[model samples]
Target: MYEPFFEMTNTPFRNDIDTDALYLSSDMSEVLSRLEYAAARQLFAVVTADVGCGKSTAIRRFTSKLSKENYEILYLSDSKLTPRWFYKGLLDQLGIESKFYRGDARRQLHQQLEIIHGIYKKHVVTIVDEAHLLAKETLEEIRFLLNTKMDSHQPMSLILVGQNELWDKLKLQHYAAIRQRIDLKCEIPQYDLSQTHEYIAAHLSYSGGAKEVFTDKAIDEIYRYSAGSARAINKLCTHALIYAAQRAKKLIDDHMIREVIAGELP
Candidate 1:
């Protein structure tokens, strides 16, 4: 409801992944470093984060910065828990046809990867999203894929991205092989207080808010309620902006902040 009163061009705290609103917090930067390290070393890297914690955003940022001349990537966002469907998704991502059978599907995938390894002296990265949904047998199948290495060269680097539960599920004793193969284990924690402030300001700056739009008191309240989580903070702050607009207020203060925090805003 708020917009014209605050002179804001758009909402600031959207939960969606917006590269323009990305705040390079220290933790996110560290995770990016891990990704780069894993890619450079050709190791099997994995990143796990809770939902709405910007894991996908981090991956998108990482992919944008890669050296195109040396990297051939196949990103698969939907890989179910069944080994057969997982194999089929990989094949489809690589444009390799399968006979609709897991055995033949896997054979085709392995042969195609081997061919790619020889023909293109570039690194192959297979990014699997929502990996936490993968069943134990499916995870074992992934481990088997990792075993298909050519000499000292690992044909493909598997990067598993999923929610926090994926890490817990992977810790089961039976999945030890898959756990052991993860060279990089990184998690995205919630944003810190300063990060929250910067995050809001960055987005607001894009949306036409002045530096003085959010006072220190208001920012502190946001951080307190959001617990430094970017997702929560965005929700609260965005609502507060709308509150100000509804009240025809030009500046956000403790009162408006409390209104949002209390769920009083429409």
Candidate 2:
């Protein structure tokens, strides 16, 4: 409803937005560069951030830039993951039929990764998203995977993407093996007030809306309520636009943001 009023060619605050249109703030750029470096070196890396801080988006941007011929990237995100299922998922992504037992499946996955890295001369990058929810057994299996070839050579690069709790989980004494193998640890920072404004304006501009569609006061309210979370900002801005459209308002102002925050507007 607000698209016509705002002259937006597409919805701006959508969650599944194209990575090409993402506003790469300095912090985001640095995280992406570090992720790329981990991939290039086939190292075990951990990336953690607060919920809705755009860690997955950063991973998408990084993987999208990798050459298909040189890299095989497998992405897995399952909150209720188990060791058997984890091995099965990896085999599925590698196009290999999983073995009947978890042990056999694990060996098969390791062998396949070795072939991909040594025979095909391509680095295999496995990205496990939402890894904080992984069972202790599953995490232990991950550490065992890293132990292939007695750590002489990294068969594949493993990237764990999760919330801050994942870091705490890794710090446990029982998980020391995996913790020590993590070569790179990165955390995505929340946007500052200035970055928040630029983020909102960039999204609006990318969607063909005028940068001034959201007034400064409205942006301030959004930042105040969202705490610099990209997902929260998108939710607030989307509702504000809908509310403004319903009231036939041309500009999204602080009042509209307030209404959205107070649940006065759907």
Candidate 3:
């Protein structure tokens, strides 16, 4: 409804943004670089962040940049996944019909990964999102999966992306084996004040809107309410734009953002 008023080609602050247009803050740049290194080296990497910190988005960006000829990226995100289903899920991604038993399925997965690495010369990168919700048994199985030819070569790059609880969970004695295997660990920090402003502007610019549509005071209010979270900032700014348009306002200001935050706008 507000696109024309704002002279935008598309709706800004959309959650499902194109990875090509993603804003790369300095911290995000470093995280992506490290993740790329881990993937290239076929290492076990763990990325932890608070909810709405853009962990999934960063991973999407990373995968988008990978070459299909050299990397086979398989992404899985199931909070209630079990050990049996975990193996089945991986096998499904690998285009293999899983065997009846869990052990058989695991062995088949390892073999397929080995073939993909050795014969096809393509490194498999497996990303497990929401891994904090994985069952202990499922996590144990993942550790064993990483044990495939550990003495010689690593066949696949495993990246576990989850909320900060995942990092805490790894600290437990029972999960020590998996923790020790983590070759790279990274976290996506919440956006700082300046980055929050840049983030809103980037989205607006990407959608062909005037980057200065949001006033300085309005951004301050957004950051105050969102606490530097990209997701929260997107939501607040989107609502603010709608409210501004509804009021026939020329530019989004502190009053519009305040109204959106206080739920005063209908």
Q: Which candidate wins on lDDT?
A: 2
Residue-level lDDT for 30 in candidate 3: 92
lDDT of 1 at 260: 77
Sorted on lDDT, best first, the list reads 2, 3, 1
lDDT of 2 by residue, 150-217 (tens): 77978788999999999999999999987999999989989899999999988998888777888999
Minimum summed lDDT over a 10-residue window in model 2 is located at 257-266
Off by over 4 Å in 1: 1-11, 15-21, 264-266
Regions of candidate 2 where Cα sits further than 4 Å from its true position = none
Could you tell me how far off, in angstroms, the CA of residue 155 lies in candidate 1 after the best superposition?
1.7
> What is candidate 1's lDDT per residue for 147-179, written digit by digit as tens?
764436566778889999999988888888788
User: What lDDT, from 0 to 1, does candidate 3 have?
Assistant: 0.88
Q: What's the TM-score of each model vs. the native?
A: 0.88, 0.95, 0.97
What does the lDDT come to for candidate 1? Answer: 0.77
Q: Tens digits of per-residue lDDT for model 3 on 1-266? A: 88888889978888778998999999999999999999899999999999999998899899999999999998889999988888888889888888889889888988898899889999899999999999899999888887755546666899999999999999999999889989999999999989998998889889897777889998988999889998888878878877788888868888878878889433
What residue pairs clash in candidate 1, if any at all?
A: none
- lDDT (C-alpha) at residue 106 in model 3: 84
- Model 3 clashes, total count: 0
